[model samples]
Structure formats: C-alpha cells, structure tokens
Target: MSTDLDYLQTVLPAPSARLAGKVVLVSGGGSSGPGWSIGKACCVTLARHGASVCVLDANLDAARDALCAVKALGAQGIALQADVADAAAMERAVQAVMSAYGRIDILQANAGIGKVGGPEDIALADWERIQKVNVDSLLIASRLILPIMSKQGHGSIITVSSVAGMRYLGYPHLAYNVTKAAIIHFARMIAQQYAEQGIRANTVVPGLIDTPRVRNTVAKMFSADDFEQAKAARDRQVPMGRMGTPWEVANAVAFLASDEAAYITGTELVVDGGLIGKYV
Candidate 1:
C-alpha cells in the first residue's frame, strides 16, 4: 500500500500519448533549493506525456538537473539558462528552443518570486523585482511566442498564478498578490485575442503547495522559523487538511497542454485542494 507522501514523491507516467510530438518550453524549471519545484515538475510531467521539453532557468545547474529527469523518462529535452524577465535573454531562450526543437507547441510561463510584505512595508526594489519576475516575464514570453504559435496555427500557453491571486491568503504581500492576479487576467486576455489564431491561453492557480520555494520563503513566514510548524499550519488551513504537491499542479498543466483541453481557454484552473472553495 502506498501513502499520500509516497504518491507526492513519485512521478507517474502518462496514461496516453496525448502530447506526442509536441514541444514544450518551461521557464523557471528549477527548484529554488531542493526537491520538486512546480516548474520542474511541469517539465517532467510534460515530458512524460510525450512532449519534448525545454527547461529554462536563470540557474544553469538547476535547469540541467531538470533536463536530466526529462531525458531519464526517454523524452527529448534541452536545458538553458536565461533570465525570463529580461527581454533580450528571453528572446534568445525562445530562439534556442526553436533551433533545438524546430517549434514550440506549449509555453509554461512559470517563473515567479514572492516577498512577505505589504506595499507600505515592502521595499520599492522588492516590489519591482516581484513584478518583473512574476508578471513581466509572462508578458515577454507570450509576446515573443504568440507569433510563432500563430504561425503553427495552434499552441498552448499555461501561466502559473497562485490562490493568492484570487483572494487574501492571510498574507500582506501586496506586490506578490497583485502580480499573481495580473497574470490570471493576462492569460484570459491572450486567450480571447488569439483564439482565432489557434493559440490557447490559461492560468494554473496553485494554493499552499509544498515546494522548495515555499519551504525557503513562505515556511519562514508561516512559522517564524520552524519548518514543521509551518507545514502543519498550512495543512490545517486547507479544507482537505493538507497542502498540495507540485506533481498535482503539474498534472493540471499537462492536461491544459494536451489536446484534451482543446475547448478550454480564457479560464483559470484552480489547484488548491479545496482551499479556495471553503469559507474561513
């Protein structure tokens, strides 16, 4: 018998080749510290579903590590280091993927950063950094890739947002909240504008997911230094009595990236383990 923790750690293969022959580009496809970050899990999950993956991260080592996992699944993939928020770097990154895979069928704009402060308390620089990484990067990626996707006559753009975007999660991080909300609408706008061009756009909103980034940043905020306490507190907040895993979020991305979601567009997929639905 397997436990939930076992399930969370395991990376399951696709039930079908729903994404066969497709190419996927995932930004921020690396963990901030260790374990499976959401973007890394998306890269692996897309690869598992028969899509060639390109793992792009500012950290070269992390990107390479993710690519290794993709290749281990017997899927074609490449790793590159680029700042997703830098226009020139992102353009170059997109071109590199085109060169290696010929075309990009899916773009997972997953790069994001969070700071635990309200507008009044947060440093101006921190606010700008959060916006650039969490919001501007999505714009840059979409602006560059939309034309190519239009030419292909079909593509999928999955931007990662958060439950923080939807509502207050008992946090005072104004910048982070605003950026996350912005991406949700950004995807919807693209979804409508490019629908005729055969490009689909959607947002994946995850809540209280147990990832390295959260452990390093949010755990400290939640528990005032105790990791286990942070985890327990977050778990109790969720209606399901636990935080979600990156793999579960990746599963949602994989679905949106596949043809199975052909008619789905201009929407947000909330992967919060029922937290978003229950009243506090």
Candidate 2:
C-alpha cells in the first residue's frame, strides 16, 4: 500500500500498441526497494505498449508488485520467483511463461549485483558472486531462450549495462565493471551468431540513474550519513546535471523490444544523460 502509486498512476508513459502481439520476459523484473527500478519500469512500459509481460524475480513479493503495475495497465502477464543465475530455476520460470503465453518474443536480462572494490582488495567470493549473477545468468537465460526464438524465426535479447562498463565512474567496483563490459560483448556475440536466425541482441547502458538501488547502495558508498549529499554529487557527475529516472531507461528497453528497432542489433543504446561522453 505504501508503493509509489502516484508515479504509477500519473507519471507512466501513455499506452500504445508499439509492441502488440509480443511476449517479453524480464529477468529481475522487480524493484530493489521502493519506487520503480529499471526492471519494474521495463515491465510496465512494455506492457503499456501491448506486450504480454513475464515478471521474473528472485523475490516473489517484488515480482507480484511489478505484475500489479502490468495488470493495472490492462496488460496480460505472470509473475514468478527465481534466482536468475540458477539454470534450473530459470528453466522453470521459462516453462511457466510458456504455459501461459505459448511463446517469448523478447528476453531482457536485467539481473545484476555489485560489490565495491578493486582486484587488490575485493574478496574472491564477492567477485565470483557478481559474475555469476550479472554475466552467467545472462548466458544461461540466452542459452535456454535462443532456440525458442530461433524456432519462432525472430526475437529480441536486451541487456542492461552501465557507464561503469565503459569507463570508471570514480568507483572501484572491479567485479561489477568487468561483468557489465562482458555483457555488452556477450550481446554483440549473440547478435552476430544469431542474426541469421532472426534473434536480435543489444545492450542498454545507463549512467547515474536515480533509483532505489542507487540511493541504498551507491549513495552509501559516497556519503555514509547524508544521502542527499550523495545524490547531489552523482547528479553533478552527469553532463545533464541530474541523474536520470527509471522510466527513461524503460523507454529505451521498450524501443529495443519493439519492431521500431527491427533493423537494430549488436549495439549498445546509451541512456546515460551524456555522462559517458563528457570530459573532465
């Protein structure tokens, strides 16, 4: 009941049929805390555009919460809980989606985690954990879904990366940076390998997006006491002088998932507010 009903009610994009007759499976399709995470926004945005959505998250409550947004938009969708890094669990989630929708026209890998540290100091376990969740999960999901897409003779695979992947953001999260970089290449490879089969793959790179995850995790790294200060610091880092909203990223994902991007593949759509191109 304490959810961001205001944003959900008034701030969402106007509905359209840009993605009519498609099914989009979003991994980690839930909010990390309050408000809209990129994954949750993607679910809502895609649904608003007429794609039947499958909200898959490790947290059932979070998944259902996102599903509510999809359903509220008068869109069809199902929510399921699973660790995206777990092959068996993801397989089951795909099975459940298949049972309900019969086919998947798009796969969006949005599951990711980070531990702030450089190689000289980062724990080995932490390194492996980030890779497993961020990289391996994408691999597993794409591996399982590729054949289904191939059979359909068309599909879109979208990935979420960060400006961190392309360059340092004044942070030292080595594992996170590596995994994100790997994701871009992973999508590119899949794009080339599966182009003939009609499966298009691309990555979305966002910079300084203001979301719950940033307020909770990244903010703490900057200011242990005042999150507002942390937020301000991050905002100034963007050339646009402000952090982006989750809906902005969602719009990019929805575009990639739609036929409007039919001729696009093996590319990274940056939603970074000009942060990556800026020079200090």
Candidate 3:
C-alpha cells in the first residue's frame, strides 16, 4: 500500500505558470497560530507560480514573516498591514500594491476568525465581530479593488470559505457558518455582475483543514485521547482518509486565481479530501 507521503507526492499537481507576471493580493497572508496557515501558503504558492504577491494581515510581524517565506522561494513579495473590515485601510493597501506593482491581477480574501457558539448562546457582540471580519471585510476589500480591476479590464477574486457553510461539520459556530455562507453568495453575485467587465469571482471551500487554528481549537475542546479519536473519525469520513493541509487549499486558490481557470467563475472548488461528498 502507498503511504500518505507517497500519495501526496503522486496526487498533488506541481505549480504552473498560469499566473506568470501577475500581481496578487492575499488578505490574512500570515501564520495565525503556528506553522504556515492557508493564507501564508496561498501567498507563497502564488509567488512561486510567477505572481508578485502582496501579503496583508492585521499583524505586521506575521505578514512580514509570510513575505519572507515568499521571498525565500526567490519570488517577489511585499508585506502590508491592514484591517480587512476597514475600507480606508483597505484602500490604502490597494494603493500600496498599485505603487509597487502598477496593477493588481488577483485578490484573495481569506481573513477570518472562528468562535464556537450557537444562536441561543452566542453573544450579540461576538456575532457582530465575526460578521464584520468574515463578511464585511471581504465586501469592503472587494469594493475598493473592483474599480481598479474593472479599469484594468481583467481580474480574479477568490474567497476562502469553509465546509461548515455547505453542511454540518460537528461544530456549533452559527456566526461563522452564516458569514461563510454569505461569502459564497457574495462571490457569486460579483462574478455575475462583473462577467462582462472581465472579472471572475469564486470561492474555495476547505474542510477539516489540519492547520494550527484547528489543532488549538480541537485541543481546547477534547482531551488528548478524545482529540486523537475525533481526528481519526474525521479522517475516516473523508474518502482520502485524512484532513487536507493548507498547501492543498492554496493550490485550489492558485488555480481559481490564475488564467487557467479563466472559463470558471461564480462556482466553488471544494478542497476537502472528498469529505464533502460523504453523506455521513
């Protein structure tokens, strides 16, 4: 039988030149807890594929770290700090990108936070915070960039969503789920409204991603043995028998943002290791 490492090597597609000479912006392009997270992976992957990347995060230090990783790959990258929910800040970020690279070709809206709470128990403040960061931020950022992209005559916008928005994932985060669902719709609307303008918008949905955020959250929710057991059960649910890594999701984002996916828009690319296909 082939090992997991061998399977990954054989199954994963290598980076392509689909984004050659493009300028891409990745919000939340930084490590949130530990190791490389989805946003970080996307920044580096886009850079490796020949795009000059602008890594933006609320945490300047983390953004710099991600930019360094992209540079280490011998690709062009820059770090920018901005609150995704703030329109003026996002406009400033766009200006910086334009000054550095002349034009933007791709916009990856990936900033978000996860808090577990059901409707009855979730605080209004918490719900608002999640909505602002997860949904409003994407809206504002896209609003700022749409004109720039429209003037450029072409662009791609990719939003990162979660499987929770599509189906139950044994989590009780109502606000998070709602915000993600809204994001998918938002992308669809943008795709249709701007199709004639040469702009494409799509969503990349990831399921049970094995990132630091998931690890820490799971650790807080379950005992060590229970956590391991739960992870095993989650793996069993996936046809691929494992949770996907950040790089896996990053590859999907790269494709959706690149010219390779020019004919694709207003659709979802699920990178869930086949977990979303399982009924149970």
Candidate 4:
C-alpha cells in the first residue's frame, strides 16, 4: 500500500511525515479562479505533508476540483460544499465531515470576503456579509470542531487574517480591516480558552500577497485602471521588493496546522516581507 506516507517520502525527499495520519478540514479550500489561492495551496501542501484533507468551499465544483488536485498529487481528500457565512450551512458542513471522517484533527478557517468601501460608503448589508463570512464563520467552525478535538484530546485550529487588520495600506475598505482584526483577537482568545483542553489556535496575517481573488479588485480600489501598476506599487511597499505569493502564505498555514507547531499557539505569524516592519 503506497500511502500518503510513501508518496511524501518518494516525491518530496522530505525527512518527515509532518502530518501523517492526521485529518484536516479546510474551509474555503478551493481556488476562486484558475490560479492558486491561499486555501487551495494550503490544502495541497497539507496533503503533500501526509494529511488527509477535506476540501470545503462555497462552490461545489471548486471544492471537487481542489480535491481532484489533491488526489492527482497522490493524497487523500474529499469535497464539501458550504457557504461559510451561513450558520446552518456551516453546521451542516461540519456534520458532513464528522459523518465521513469520524474525527477532525486540524481545521484551517480560510473563508473570507472583502468589500471595497470606506466608512462613509460602506453599506450596512455589505458590512454584515463581511462579518458573517470573515468573523462569524471562524466562530462557527470553532464551535463545531472544538468539541470533537476536546474529546479526542488534541487539535489545531488556524485562522487566516490580513496585515490590514493592523494597518491600512491606502485601501479604503472598513469592513475587511475590522473583520480581519476581529479574527486575530478571537483566535487568541480561543487559543487561551482551549489550550488547557489540548487544542491550539493561531492566526496567519498575510501582507500584500499576490492572489487571484484580491489583486484586480484591489487595483480598482486604489484607482489603478492598470492592474500591473497596482502590483508594482504593492511590490515597492514590501521590503523584499515584491509582494508575497499564495504558496508562502499556504506554507505558513501548513506548518501551523502540523505537529511541528505543537507548542505554538495564540500568536500571529506575519508572512509579510517587512511591510509592517516599515509601517508599524
């Protein structure tokens, strides 16, 4: 039987099966477009490291696509459809995973949405949607998964936040910042509350990552009719002289989700290449 263990050993030449035998549930674990996304990349990386992953996304087709990618890479995976913003949908999704996998070891809450509006232009509805997607979904996923982890005596929970949570980078989005900040604080609190129960929680704060979902839309926000100009401007803001990639963010997540970070919790891992170093 060539398990994910065999695949990892032969394929990557890596020294360890970091997540061997673990089951990971990743919400938003699919690409919104044809390219790599933080969620999709994280899911694949976890699979590569020997984790059996459940790829959940609001889009069923995207979820299936991501699962197929994992399978193609010789990893175990399944597809699930859930709108993270919806409580019932998230609850049902969690139930589906429990029914299929019987237990959850790692969960990466990566579903989030950004609205392009400042305080004055922000609509109450859009703000609520952002809260539901970014903040509420995290809470819901934790509530549903923590119990199983608590019973099993161990688990890791990871939340994907943003550098915008700390500082604005000429972007005028109020809800995104607020919700992202909320995710970090909430994750810290969860970490403290569950640390005694053998459960760990952490947040990944990414800075200026070049991903398909946010680039063009953010370009519009910065009044860059030219997307390349937006990319260039963002590159200049990073100390590395370039914006980070989705894989970088995903790798951070993969590490956190693994036993490698067993003693780490309640902290924010900043994946920014010195953006906050200069600004904050």
Which candidate has the top score in lDDT? 2
Q: Please report how far candidate 1 places residue 37 from its true position, in Å.
A: 0.5
lDDT of 3 by residue, 53-114 (tens): 99999999889988887776667878999989888999999999999998999999999986
The lDDT for every candidate, in the order shown, is: 0.88, 0.90, 0.86, 0.85
Q: How far is candidate 1 from the true structure (C-alpha RMSD, Å)?
A: 3.2
- TM-score leaderboard ranking: 2, 1, 3, 4
Clash totals in order:
0, 0, 0, 0
Q: Model 1 Cα displacement at 219 (Å)?
A: 5.1
lDDT at residue 56 of model 3 (Cα atoms): 97
Deviation from truth (RMSD, Å), model 3: 3.9
Clashing residue pairs, backbone N/CA/C < 3 A, model 3: none
Ranking by lDDT: 2, 1, 3, 4
| Candidate 4 lDDT tens digits, 1-280 | 1124343344332424798888999999987777667888787788878888999999998888778767876778789999987778888888888888788999999988988789899999999989999998887888788999999999999999999998987869799999999999999999999999999999999998877787656655576456677678779989999988777887898889888899999999999998988875
Off by over 4 Å in 1: 1-9, 218-225
